[model samples]
Target: MPVLSGAEPFAHDGSEDIGVLLCHGFTSTPQSMRAWGEHLAAEGCTVRCPRLPGHGTRWQDLNQTAWRDWYDTVDAEFDELRGRCRSVFVFGQSMGGTLALRLAQQHPDIAGIVLVNPSVTTLRRAARLLPVLCRVVPAASGITGDIAKPDGFELAYDRLPLRAMASLQQLWRVVRGELGQVRQPLLLFRSNTDHVVEPVNSAIVLDEVRSSDLTEVVLTDSFHVATLDHDAPTVFSGSVEFLQRIHRERAEEVV
Candidate 1:
């Protein structure tokens, strides 16, 4: 599983004690979140965007790995950031958002969470048969590059491995059931015309999370890959504002 050129992981050491951990979606690379991480880094925030195992590589290799591998990678990164930074927040897109939510459930001490077009359920009817279907075939057509931004590629494999996708479905079920345990502040950005994930998934998350400080922003001109789409600036600037607002509130509480 040789990593691609643009799919390498990104880490930035900002001057601020605050840190941000960015997680890209399933079948996608750190390239998907590079701009957002760099934007946060420019704002003096320490940012780490790790490429998930088997990702940024080949889809066939991804079939051999499960969701636990991906979760462990991000969890280890979060633990490392927790040790170095005064306050650490997590940002995730699509399946990465599901991972972020799981991290929050395990660690309520986290500063906050930011999610974009997170996927927690299956909108595709065929996904339901994954458990049985994966045994029959190893791969399927990928659903990447669902962006309105011209020439925007996800730097992902053209094939989607059914085994890995089945594992993802299991992860979604676990995270969805534990949504109520999420107590940290939440900022979610949903794209209006997302082709990959449905809006109902976001609606379910909003209804279940117990976070008192919750905000949802709708992107009117973007698709599933909004971080690289027309409204990417919205996600970038809005996340900064979210972080600043939460930082201030925590400061006020201490005062």
Candidate 2:
């Protein structure tokens, strides 16, 4: 089933003609993408960073939801952005990137994508063991340490919901298999020092996409959460450049 363009479920009455929709990684909230969204907004792009169905408020909330719910939330947010802007782009981090891949596949109108450490491919053997592990392990938090912030502040959400991880695995399977279905331009930024998701996952994405226009950036100084790492400024600048290039192309198309 495809997510068609229409009125957004959420209200965005004061935005400009260009919109960018952002999604956060698993066990994380919209706060992870808040700065990215705001920066895009400051550049005159209408940004929508919605809390995935079971995120932001509590960890247990994730266990109650599945990947479909997460995709639906992003889909509706995309619709909202579409309603207000002439052009829209989808960007995400980690599991959020998986959802964004689904969006790019189904929503052909999307201008392009900026994927930051997208978890399209899980760690070795974990993808194989997910089915049994999810059922055996009860809902609990697995995120081990405090997510290091951009300002050197630490805000940690120390809860690992097995069900949520399971759902994410399911999404990964779907997106991983459907990578060739994505034909839009793509930008991939990866951290070589990422402690969570393996760097090879980015390699998998670049290898699978059928899109002829693709750019990749390696973040050597960052960790798993590249958005707030030492190279965060580079991530921001690169994304903005990608958006600007796409925006310019759209302008040329219009003229």
Candidate 3:
């Protein structure tokens, strides 16, 4: 399948010994994380943002994919980054965050993790019916472009593939169950007024993750897609600062 023009995956090999793997959300493409990846690259961090298995092509393609397929893509990228850098970090937005957490659970050596409005569970009554609804319906209304900035937009599918969504729910259950295994340093950026993901999602993560170093920043000016919204600068800069602090602490430990 031909990748979309702007949704293509991207990579940067930096001079620094830090590697960062970025993951975009469900039904979204690497385009959502492109700016953030570039920012990290400019800061001398090696960066890789891979297009998720079913994303960036068409909505129908997603229906044929499962959560494992998406994880395999990022998992391979993480291995590549680990092989090339002295330290590595994982950054994710929305469902991307769920994948990041799964990575941390499986790889104890990940330097740290950064998440933006990560979703592990939803309070929607309809979600309970995904297992059955997905079998009957092929797709549903899209949950994209939830940005507070009028001009901000994500290059994502306009429709939600039901089977893919059901798979995502399965992924959420697995991640939430293993949250205690995530022991790396963590930074989470959450929107104060997100229309897509509810506040309970972040609350559940903070409470369940066993990470000793956990920090959360609330974005008052953005919605679900905070990466491309008004507080994007805050998300970008704060992530850099968090990464630097983790790197510095590791260096001091080696001294």
Candidate 4:
């Protein structure tokens, strides 16, 4: 059992061949993924949710980080999982999902991907004014309006980081360009009332990916943060089933 460092803010008991590495969305902490990781761990799998750079701390801390640093954080976590598990699965929420997609493209060791309200594409209106808005906006918190936060978690800031938003736009551009290359099995969850990523992003994944096996669940009862919302149990059970099926298939292949 490899002990994860608190600097990463992850909870892992041991190394298991079947491992799941979870990434939380931008402006969020691994705490968001903690419940799902615990649920999965109870089902006899090793699970980890690592805090990305600039997360689990102050919002200004994130403003200093770039996409590469964020990606590298997840990448290191993925590498650790690869070392311990015979097969690995990756999942993420919102911006984290964007990182998962990038990882799935590059890591053949990854067996599957689960995306929860992933921000595959930037907000539509923002996409048009990305260049100017990114510069115009200042580093602050990311929460706004009546955004219902996950229980017990406070957003690092109340305003969005302009440069980080710009980086997201750029990351989406990269993911969009490489969409066809993501051939891993996929499980996509999207909220019907999501105020963030557009619905069409999930539709794009359903349409463009060449993967023969894909499943999508529409969370009718939740808002953007479905993993921690009313439909969270559904999210947990469905994801565990998906991971189990993939694990079984791999086990049979080895036999």
Candidate 5:
């Protein structure tokens, strides 16, 4: 399948000492994360952002994919980064955050993790009907492009695929159950007024994760897609700082 014009996956080989794996949200393309990846690369960090399966092509294609497919893609990228760099970090936006957490849980060597408006659970009442709706409804209104900036946009599908979302919910359950296994340093960015994911999602992550190094920055100006919104610089800069701090700490421990 041909990727959308701006949705192709991107990579930057900046340094062998540090690598960052970026993951975009469900139904969204790598375009949403390209700028952030470039920022990390500018800071001398090797960066990679992979296009998740069933994304950046057609919404219907997502229906044929499961959450495991998305996780597998990022997992492979993480392994490749780990092989190339002395230390590796994982950054994720939305469902991508869920995958990041799962990676940390599964891989004890992840240097750290960063998240933007990650979704672990939703308060939407309609979600209760997904089990049945996915059987009858193929798609619903998309929850994309929630940027507060006037010109900011995410390359995402306009329709939400039911089966894919159902698979995502299953992934949430698995991640939440294994939160205690995620002990890596963590930084999370949450939008104060997100239209897609609620604040409770971040709260759940901070509360449940076993990471002793935890930080949260509230985004006052952005919505769900803070990585592309007015507070994008905050997300980008803060992530770089977090990576530096974690790398320093790891170096000290090694010394």
Candidate 6:
């Protein structure tokens, strides 16, 4: 299947030595993170938002892929920025947030992390039946376009591939186990009425992660896709400020 029109990956090389790796969620495309990436780029920060494997394409293709393939892609993107930049930060929404935590777990040198409604676990009872559901029915209704902004769009697969969802659960479990290892300074933006990831997801991270420098901001109006919703400016501006703080603190540490 041909990729969606506006679902391509994006990258920008800025004059600053700091780099930011942005990631979207399951069944989602780089389009979800484009605004945040562009905002960082405009502020003279190198940014990369890669199209995850099996995403931004036909839903059928997503079923053929798994978490490993997706993680490998973002991991490579991280390696690229690590080589070129003096410091690197990661930003993600939903499952992208899960992947970002995985990156921080594996690479401890990351400057920090900024997340928007990241998903680590789902308390939904229906999720428990996924293994059987995958065999009986390949997919169900997708979860996308949850932004509160009127006419807001999320470029993602319309069908929720059950197999892909199963893979995501595995990632969630694995990341949860390693949550204690993510010590980077963190900033997480959460939506009050998110239809996707819930408050428990954030609670687990806040309770488990060892990062002493952590901040959480609650969005009163935006839904899951806060990056493109009304609070986007809050997210974008907060991220720039977060990165700047990390940069200054890191430099001070060197002295």
lDDT (Cα, tens digit) per residue for candidate 3, span 25-77: 99999999999999999899999999998899999999999999999999999
TM-score between candidate 2 and the true structure: 0.88
Error of 5 at 93 (Å): 0.5
The residue-by-residue lDDT of candidate 1 on 1-255, one tens digit each, is: 568999999999985568999999999999999999999999999999999988987889999999999999999999989988877999999999999999999999899999999999977889889999999999999989999988777788788899999999999999999999999999999999988899999999999999999999999989999999999999999999998888778878889
Q: Per-residue lDDT tens digits of candidate 6, residues 1-255?
A: 677989999999995569999989999899988988888999999999999988887998999999999899999999999999988999999999999999999999999999889899999999999877887788899898998999789999889999989999999999999999999999999999998887999999988999999999999979999988999999999999999989889988999
Pairs of colliding residues, candidate 5: none
Worst 10 residues of 4 by lDDT: 1-10
lDDT of each: 0.93, 0.77, 0.95, 0.78, 0.94, 0.92
**Candidate 4: lDDT of 131?**
71
TM-score of each: 0.98, 0.88, 0.99, 0.90, 0.99, 0.98
Runs in model 1 lying further than 4 Å from the true structure: none
Location of the lowest summed lDDT over 10 successive residues in candidate 6: 14-23
Q: Which stretches of candidate 4 lie over 4 Å from their true place?
A: 1-8, 139-156
Q: What is the alpha-carbon lDDT of model 5 when measured against the actual structure?
A: 0.94
Candidate 3 residue 174 C-alpha distance from true site, Å: 0.4
Q: How many clashing pairs in candidate 1? A: 0
- Model 2: how far is 179 from its true place, Å? 0.7
Q: Cα RMSD to native, each candidate?
A: 0.9, 5.5, 0.7, 3.8, 0.7, 0.9
Which residue runs of candidate 3 sit more than 4 Å off their true CA positions? Answer: none
